[model samples]
Target: MTESSPTVWGVGTTRTLRAHWALAEAGVAYETKPIQSRSGETQTDGYAALNPKQKIPFLEHGDVKISESYAIVDYVFEVFGGDRVYRPATSAERAASNEWCSTILMELDAHTLYVMRRHGDLKDLYGAAPAAIDAAKEYFTKLADAMVMKLPAGPTCLLSEKISVADILLMSCLDWAVLYQVPVPEAYGDYRKRMSERPAYQQAFDFNFEVLGVTHKDLPR
Candidate 1:
């Protein structure tokens, strides 16, 4: 990799997909260093030195290292997007993008979808909790209802006419929800279908599967 090339340190997961989608949308030339959690690659001392938290999808740009998917996506947009379609233009647009992304990450992805995964598909790794799973399902249903209300009248984008980080973030999370069998609101079905057709999203999906040695069918759909 060149000195100017950014590197992403994970693959397969939606969190990593967020980084890839943002970079692709911004037309950033980047490299991937696939670290498989299933193989314990993230637990090693080498990876730990890069991120003490030992999380997947950490980003390295020059000497700067950033962990967490949302932060990485925002950093990519600010540093590389500029006037690109991935970065919002006006203050209202920026706020809308932030609101959508934050809501998806916190209210849906982290609290609900992930909780469902922990208890459902990833029970072996995280230990299953029936009550937690049930509660998460209930909470996720409510959140999905809210998402349905916020969804723009779109064949174009989420916050605006142009695609932004909010769309990327929401699409990634919704894909996760689909894979994990979490209930997605019917209103979002069309939005998901539309965003899934994006070239950037397709490229990111291909890269993710190629690096992780998994196919679409291999995921929990």
Candidate 2:
């Protein structure tokens, strides 16, 4: 729990939110070197030494320096070895959680981010023709519907009923989704609201924006 032990370098509104959420939930003390997208900090040789990929959300624990969001999550789970609330116990439940997290990151998050990039900086960012906004919107619509259908069946729902890593990952993605003005259906909208109401989610939201000094207001209306 010492400040010098586990240091994290992460970016604003990135999957580093996942690491922050897990740290907060686990009650672990960590020092965060938050990077900005436009600041060029991520590309510096100093940072590149820690993370060859030159990406934010890289973690350094003494001799260990790790990159990748999921890898950091796993490391947090192991090092803290507490907060079973964020991590499911049973193998079946853990498997399901992993599946949902992977599905969201691998499929839904990319699709949503593509739509965001296309809408926000398509020509300048990639210098290529982008997909139609309407088509992207429709794609998000289908993704939302499918995600909503995956909501838990029993008393323990993904957002409202229990605190799971899936909830954290989903909350992180939704943070960007909201800022990017990604069109989520009513069901997913409600789900996002439910997650946002939680204390952990609130902390993550405040920390991400505060450290980054960016305004969601800049997002498209």
Candidate 3:
């Protein structure tokens, strides 16, 4: 750790994956506080102040404490995000970036989390719902098809050029999906392979698995 390193309080399996990868991309120094909230420590009084939702991925930049994955990423981009090239250099590019990021959350992550929170190994951490699990898997199949068509490629999409927060968000969700054993539609196989090939993606994936203590059977709760 150094004076420039940002201090981040991250819980297991949280969106901190995105923040961690972003820091790595920006070549920024940072420390992980590891809230260790596996037993609900985040609900405790002290930790609650850092996040209204008592969530993981709370970041402390000097005196400026922040919460939420997107907000934290936006802040990082605004301050230490360097030249706009990493995300979008112009208004239209940024808008496109936002579109891709939204697609990851609204379509990809939502459905995947449902499966994890319902079936898979998440029951050990947050209980289970079979219906939710089924629906989640079902939903993701559609998303996979849509992604296969859009596929975040070409000069306009995030993966087409340089990796961006959009790629980080999508890749993080896909990594979780693999751990959960949710069927990855055949269409997404190529996309997954592309993301896996990136060095930054690999770094984040290894760190996430190591920190979460996961094997093939484990899914983040």
Candidate 4:
């Protein structure tokens, strides 16, 4: 790989998938480091030197270094905007897009799905809380249903007809929710099916998840 080619670190998680997916959508050539979370790899001296926070989905393109998955996606589109993917063009558009991204990341991802992951799947490490998990699941359903209702009746994405980072972010969270067996709106199901068929998303899914011996079809829809 050329030194200037983008490098993405981490795999096997929805967050990491977002980074790879954005690069694929942009049709950018890049390299992969394939680190896993909680696997002691992120704690290594080399990785820690690259990112003190030790988060996956980190991107390094020349002098640009971004740790968060959302920021990485945003950076890619800024450098390589395309017809295949949508990045906000105006100040008002960017603000609205940011609103959708922030809500999805917080409401559907960190605030809901990860709550179940923490207290349910990783209970041995994070401790179990049946009540919290149940509450979180209910919260996810309510918010998702409400969000679906707000969508302009018939478009494949969250922000607009063209797929954007907001759509990718929301799609990743929705996929995570489905894997966790959280109830989601029927509109969400339709949107997920359509978005999953995107060639870029398909490529990213394989690159981001094939290392783990699973595919989207292997998981529940």
Candidate 2: tens digits of C-alpha lDDT, residues 1-221:
56456887875765877787777666678888878544789889888777789876888888888887777867776777464555566888778888788877776667666555656565566554445555665676677678777876554548335466677667666666666666666666556656656565557556867765754333332
lDDT for model 2 = 0.68
What's the distance in Å from true for residue 55, model 4? 1.7
Tens-digit per-residue lDDT, 1-221, candidate 1: 67899999998788888888889888888998888656789999999989999987899998999998889988888888877675666898778777887788898888988888777878998998999988987888788787676788757688766677777778887787777677877888777777777788778888886865754445443
**Model 4 ranges with Cα > 4 A deviation:** none
RMSD of each: 2.4, 3.4, 3.9, 1.6
TM-score of each: 0.89, 0.81, 0.80, 0.93
- Colliding pairs, model 4: none
The residue-by-residue lDDT of candidate 3 on 1-221, one tens digit each, is 87767987774573777777677666677888776545577888888877788877888887888887877776776677676326576888778778778877877776566455646566876676777777787787667667666665443424446666777777677776766676776756666666566565456545655755753234322
Residue pairs in clash, model 1: none
Q: Write the per-residue lDDT of candidate 4 for residues 1-221, one digit (tens) a residue.
A: 88878999999999998998888888888999999987899999999999999879799989888999989988887787567667677998889888788889888898999899999978999999999999999999998887766565674576677778888898898888877888878876667878888899888988789878878667565
All candidates' lDDT scores?
A: 0.81, 0.68, 0.68, 0.85
The candidate that wins on TM-score is: 4
